[model samples]
Target: MNTIWLGFSQKLLKVDRYIKKSFTYQAIEKTFAIILPFIIIGSLSMALSSSVFSKQGFFNQIYDISSWLPYEDVIKKVLEIINTVTMNFIAIMTAFLSAKYITRSFKKDEQIAGFTGAIGMLILNYNLASFTSDSNQETFLMQDLGIRGIFISLILGVFVGYIFKWFSPRNKQEKVDQYTFISRGVGGLLPLAIVLGILIGLTLLASMINQMGVNGLFYSLFRLTEIKSKHLIITILFLAFFNSILSGVGISGPLGIMQGGLDDTSIVSNLSYSLKHGTSFGVPFPISIHTIYDSFGSFGGTGMTMSLIIAILVASKNKNSRKIAKFSIIPSLVNINFPLMFGLPIILNPILMIPFIISPLVSMIIGYFFIYFKWMPPAVYNLPRTTPAPLMAFLGTNGHWSALFVSGIVLVVTVLIYIPFVKLNNQAALIDGGDLNEK
Candidate 1:
């Protein structure tokens, strides 16, 4: 078993190196790196908004701040705007940065490529009906321009960047003069036109088909998981697997696709039933995706990343890994793991992939059994996504001690599962002679 594990780790390391060398992967990494600060700030704002400011927030539930806090409404509004620009527009920013980096990789006019990528994203999300209607109002589909659209944004950005690379001249090595600047601008015009034309054509085609665009189609596929069925566990596992894989590739999962648990039918029904029955003990969906995955599996964000952080801090000797884990702790406590995802870069790291995918599924299964056997009630309250992980099940079940205990047990099990993977990652780094403290 040891020999087999070692061989698999070696093969995984090779795959990791190969992926890191790819231009597209490099572009995605740099895009995430560049946008990480915004993600952190946005996460902080979201955490505060959900936990402190909102009437339904965790803190507000504990004690109503609005009754006496000065300028609470104004502060809440400011935070909302901040969250809107930083989080709601993340995909647009991703498009710009991704195209910039990809164009830079090909020595093309990166600034123009970045603009083109952003414009292309906008074009793809453009709704003709919004403009054509007589309401004298324009509506931008936030779903297509926000976290939900990241996968499409990255694809579009890469496409735009490559178009520039194919059509535009390589950047000059020498110092740029006015003539050179004009020449470069003129050279990019063709690529710019080509990319924008393609995007425009696609938009028009989507409109002609009476479709919202690629992202709309993508989410439509996701909505298929919402079908009610007797095979509840199968559906939950499918979602868990799909969400894990998408998140592994740096795309926002379905849970992150819609914040606040507002649109999820199962969550709504569970909450409604619990409220009506005055207890979560026998809610209709006692083992739903929300009751299991969101309540327990998603501790410290997707894949129960808090476990990863704990594993790193406890088992990793790599300075960089330890540093990242420390930095990620606070955010992870609030169920925000973007810093760790991009910084430790679980996105493309094959070494962590197994545990990253497995830990959450394991936790979800444990949670399912706990609720199934009546060891705890299902989490039925609609708490903020930013609520601390261990407390989520407890609060959602309206102070169920057994729910909290189950959550704690799940966290410990996931941490154990991740520890071995974290050690394997450290071993891989040592084998590669990589500087553990580098950057």
Candidate 2:
């Protein structure tokens, strides 16, 4: 048994090393981790103003100064603007960050990389000709600039980085004082011009394809927002499982790539139909896997690792585990678990992989059944993905306390599920001569 375990550990470490070395994983992982603070702030802002909490939560009662203010509406608008600036431009920011990371990896110019990312995103999402022709300022849809565009932005960022790197002067023998600003400008100009021309050509091609009665590739990718039927439910379960597996191997899961296009419209439509017919919404909610996996299954980002943090804090016998728990507690509270996910180094660890992937699946199943049986109302409101679990359930269900209660129950259950795994992980660390006093 010990030999078997040893061999398994060795293989796990190998896979983990490969994943860490992959450039795509490193770029996406760093980009997501960097943007998490913004996600947390934006989520909190939305939660405070959401119908579920705007006039009812303890925050409203304690901070009722808005009621006394004559300019309460103005204050509300300012809050909305804050949320808009932070969360509404998430894709643009992610593009910049991803390109920046890739540029640094290639030892190229990071500032230009960020600029290219932002510029590419703009070209991909908007047509400059149409914008210049339109006199109306409200022509652009904000959703296209936010989470809806993340996948496109990510692709564009990486492409820009690679294109720039290729265009960078390579031969040291032909070096014309490349360190000078003049030499750098001369080298970079062609790449910038070439990329811009390619963007225009691609846009024209997409337009031509749309006019030719073909479903344009860009539109198909951007418009896949609703999932229906039992088949899609099974497909999403597999997608979630696959993403978790990737995450466990130290690769950033492709949630935004594989499932980002899906939205909460199906659940909203079901709720609307139920209201119109004066009947309770049922079974369909069981298949609303988009919101379920996001709000419940991803209790603490990718492998439901937040519960593991809780377990480490409350039940661990190892000092290193508790130290990691303390450091990760704040970020986990806001639904950012990168520190715990990588630091406790759940990424490469075999002992935790089973529960890491399965726990979220189990949570999804439970949340679905709970909603299906009317134990909790179906989530209708489209809350931010960064919304923490219990509040996520509440806001999503539009003030359904039962949903909040179920979220709490799920948290406890997740922690309980993580206990044995945490214990085993601690034992493995001890046996492998790993540090127990890590800060």
Candidate 3:
């Protein structure tokens, strides 16, 4: 068994290396790495603002104590606004980061490229009619400004980055005073002008396409808002697999697509059924990716790395691994695992890849069965996506202890599954001369 496992690990490492060398993959990885702090901040704001623990969150819970606590309302409002601005604008921010990394890869001015990409993103979603003489033809929708826009934003980022790279003065060694900021600013003129021109042209082309009764590229790409039931489980499994694989390469797949395009038809349908029946006692929610998978399958963020964090804390003797676990604990509680994911540098590590991909799938199945068997009530409340696990189950199921209990069980299972994998990783690190103790 050891020999067989060794052979598989060698092959997996080779594939991992090949993937790391891909320019596209590297761009995506670096984009996520750059934007990770935003994701964490946004998630933290959402979690704090959510009334998961109460009927009306922090404000309502503290309503009666208003006289004692000054500025409760002010604090609450600040958190909500923070959530709106940061979490709500993730798509546009991602566009900026993607372009920044892609342009940097081409050895061009990344800041200029990033600014251009941000402008392009805003223009693509901007309502021309609202700003122009056609006031009666307002076409901008609020949904398009958020998660739905991520896919197109990423594509546009790459497009704008490439255009900037193409127009940048290449292979020219001009002697200029390094101390002069104006010299650098002037150097960006050609690429900036060209990128802006193309952006304007694309906007006109999109408008023309809209006039022909076609939804245009922006609408077509962002309109995948539904994931119907025919192959729902299969879709969940595939998403779980793909998201893990992408995260293994340091790309956030859920932030890119799954979280954006996933439909909640099952959750909605089940809630409607429960309402009409007047009792949710025996009826269970259908196998729902949003309710079960989102709440439990991704217990510790993208690759469900929380379990791995636990394993590292409990079983690993390596001080570096323990330190990672220490730093990751608080973030893990909030369902943010990027620190561990990137710091442990799970990206492209062959040994950790296997269980990283499999753990979520296993957890999804476990959660589905628990709900299907009526071991817990269906998750009716649309809890915040950033709501931490087990508690997410509790709030989502409307104060069901059973749901929380089931979530606890799934978390334990996840931890157990990750133990051996963590052990293997630790052993390999030790063999490779990894520092086992703190200096």
Candidate 4:
């Protein structure tokens, strides 16, 4: 088993190196690094707005902060705006930064390319029929301009960058003059036209489909899949796996999409049953994405990454890894792992990918069995997304101690699963002559 593991780790390291050296990966890494501050701010804003200031928030319910705190309503409104701008507009920011980095990678006009990419993203989601309306206001598909549209944003960004690289004239002279600026702007015109033309065409098609009453085709497909699945367990596991993979590649997954202010039918049913029975025990749809994956598998955010942070703190000797883990603890506790995701650089990490995907699946399986055997009640309450992992199941089950205990157990198991992989990452760093402490 040891020999087999060592061989697998070596092959994984090779793949990691190849991926890390790729232009796309490098561009993405840089993009994430640049936008990380915004992500952190957005995360904190969401946590505060949803979990601290809101009337239904865990802390607000306990403390009744609005009654005592001065200008509480104003503060909540401010935070909400901050959260919306930073989080809801993340895809546009990502497109701008990704295009800039990718263009830089090719020694092209990054500024113009970046702006072009942002314009393209906006055009892709723009409602063309808004032009025919009485109101002068232009409408955009706000949903696709946020986290839900990041994958599309990334694609458009990269495509725009490449088009600029291929079509725009390369900067050959070292000296900068007014003529240089003119030449750069002229050079980018072709790429900009091509990108916007393509984007407009796609938008027109989408608008036509919407006119035909085929709205939300992307969301409808997933909803249909959920409605049609015969085996609940298999469906849950498949979503967990699929979500993990998409998240690993830095795209928002189905889980994220489904959970965006839209309650799952199973979750709604379970919640209704629990409310009527005054207990989560024997609730309808006991084993569900909410009860299992969200409750157990999402500890420390996507991939049970909170466990990865703990594992790194316990087993890794790298100073950078440990420092990042320490910095990430607060955010991870509230189910925000963006710090660790980009800081530990888990987005494209190969070694961590193993546990990053596996840990969640294992946790979900444990959660399923725990609910199946009546060891704990199923989750029923709709808690804030920023709620702490251990408390999620407990609160969701209406203060079930057994649910909390089971969540704790799942957390420990996920940490154990990540320990060896963390050690392997340290070893790989050493082999590459990289200073783990400095990295």
Candidate 5:
């Protein structure tokens, strides 16, 4: 083993320094840290979508408009509070992730604490901000405050580094000068102030405009006297249906097109949600890809109708395999449905086609009834499905808690739809190689 290790090390060291430095380690790091693991999000998405579409699904059971405050408002309120808190939470996490990466290199706990504080400021204490609009340059970066998060983290790291260095004797020098023009005297902090001023000024202007412009203008549009009271429910229903289907379409098509279109859930949900909000076309929203893609945005096609496909994949196996399949079922319930689907490649399989095709549509139909009859409200935005699909769907749609029951219903329906197909597919596979080619 030592000879092999030494031999490989010598061979690796023999490579050109420039080529090795640029690609080798960095390339391998990105593959495991970013790419390969990315596929798992796709699987998670499948679990998420299936959960949403199940008749016993979360969307159906969530809080409805009828449950407003004092009665069921408790339910709705919890969802609202979550949505409000998490709107830009992903972006804030991103900044911390960046800070964490930088700090982790030195094995310092202060790195996490420092970035967490800075992330809090950008998220709760500030507004959406930016520096550059051009996407082509390496100079571009963004976070919770949009581009402002990127700039602030750099500046804050410098400022924090200064305070930290002054207090902690081990590290006396900082890299603030990289961001600012000067590093000493009042002039040194001047650049930091300028950046802060711009952010503050832009935020003030935006706030003022909302108060004096769009928000005010829109408030009047929603006024009972200004718009028809009769059309309210109808408008809500249309929007609800459109939003639900639109979400499914995005997750199924563009997002998971790589997974046989509708086979993947994360891709479908995000793409559907994105296109609905016009994010794919450059418009950004609180729940847009700018906030979701890297983390929870890739689970749609992997989950939707795929959960049943997964169960089918597992159910078709031997008793030992069935045990494993049964075990995966519970985890899939909370949006971890990949153990069976990929475990058996039910992606484009002809037998498991039963659930793949029916689950989502059935869920959509059931979900539609809840919205149609005013049992639930539309999902207003995208929330991290990691927080349990029912709960997340409830909050994601802005206190439309009825979405939870609707989602639960969808879940039941998905399982039912898969039952027959799973049995048939299992029998066929058993006759074949018992692994797919035995026959």
Candidate 6:
């Protein structure tokens, strides 16, 4: 009775902390990690497809069959080179920015301690991909955040460091200090502040520039989008997934090419094609849910759009996580998609295990139910995913409008499903008292 009573006591004491730690933050972060890669790719693909068709430019002949055979295969190679280069550049930016944000934001400790702790966790987070990948199960790094090597590194680094600080030797004396802001790592705090300022400032500068000129930004956007290699859904899911693993060791695409022998496998592409042409939406096969996006002519992606919403909604609810939340999402919305992914580490976390599986299943089930009930039309349309995905899906359905409504329904359902799990996990975390990262 006493032991049982103690267990109940612990549960009661930590319930609020659980809610604080989990919920919106985890879901959104997972959303960020997986979907951002596709957003970049899809946006790039749409840009290319649009340019090729409009101007008869480099990518204009994408539909031409001769290009992939002997003489024209070079076009494919060039496109491959461009994609690799772009992905690499992106990986670097995400790494540095993500690393700094996670470490600094969650630290809430002395400047160097939080920063160093964040850095320390970084290495472990990157390792999580290999740490979690399995043949039967989807990769542990999570599909929403493709090219996860960087995001995980950033996330784990921050998490571990903050945890470390929480366990800092100053426990007894420090707890007595009333105002935390005045505590600082006090002296080291200034440098930490400067580092954070610099990172934020640089990101803002980039955003302002991108937002300033619409046409130029659009053109740049087109060029980037046009740089895709083909069978986009697959590319986003598999190749992007593959890229995450390689990124951990700093071995990006060309770097892999330099290694000699190669193996080709693209599960996401095969799945994407099956989702579009192979399987009918009503079929019980799981991929039909993708048709949810397909209901619109322009909706080529389902994973990222929903992922972003999940991340945003989850992060907003968790007050402690907002520091990381606020900055990550804006840039994420634009094309550089890391803010949400690593900021929260939603993918492999045990707390989210239920929702990750449940949300997708529920979304597909509800989507199917709506279609069957005649409350919503079948998602038979096809279109590229660009700009904002969910909203685009709404327009592509020829204003089926119901798809948008359905998407909203799915988002709300996902949140409802994910909340309790997040709460349980967050409470576990607080009681366990954070990662080895500084508090």
**lDDT for each residue of candidate 4 in 82-135, tens digit (9 for 90 to 100):** 878887887888889889888877878788889998888788777665778778
CA lDDT for candidate 6 = 0.41
lDDT for each residue of candidate 1 in 158-248, tens digit (9 for 90 to 100) = 9988898788865566322433767978987999899879888888787776566767766656554553446777666667777888788
lDDT of 4: 0.78
Instruction: Give all candidate RMSDs, comma-separated.
Output: 3.7, 7.3, 6.3, 3.7, 18.3, 16.5
User: On residues 218-330, what C-alpha lDDT tens digit does candidate 6 reach at each position?
Assistant: 22332343223453333323433333333322222221232122112222443454367643233332223234322321111222324434554564455544544454443
Best by TM-score: 4
- Tens digit of per-residue lDDT, candidate 2, span 217-292: 4445423534344666566677678778867754454566656445456766766765665443452544555557
**What is the C-alpha lDDT profile of model 3 across 88-165, one tens digit per residue?**
666678678778878777777777788888877776766655656655765553455554455566777788778867
Report lDDT (Cα) of residue 107, candidate 3.
71
In model 6, where do residues sit more than 4 Å from their true spots? Answer: 1-290, 293-320, 331-337, 435-439
Q: Residue-wise lDDT of candidate 5 within 1-439, one digit each (tens)? A: 8788456434433332233243222222221232112234343333433333333435423532243424443544454444334322333443344334333333333343345435434533342223333444322122233221322333344343333333332322444333333323333233334434544564456445443222122222223222223543333233223322423221112222111321245345655764586433222222222122211222233335334545445455456346446545544546454344334334334445435555554555565456546555444444434445444445655555466666666666666766756665555445443322111
RMSD of 3: 6.3
> Would you list the C-alpha lDDT of every candidate in the order shown?
0.78, 0.66, 0.66, 0.78, 0.39, 0.41
> Which pairs clash (backbone N, Cα, C closer than 3 Å) in model 1?
none
| Clash totals for all candidate models | 0, 0, 1, 0, 69, 45
lDDT head-to-head 5 vs 6, winner = 6
User: lDDT of candidate 3?
Assistant: 0.66
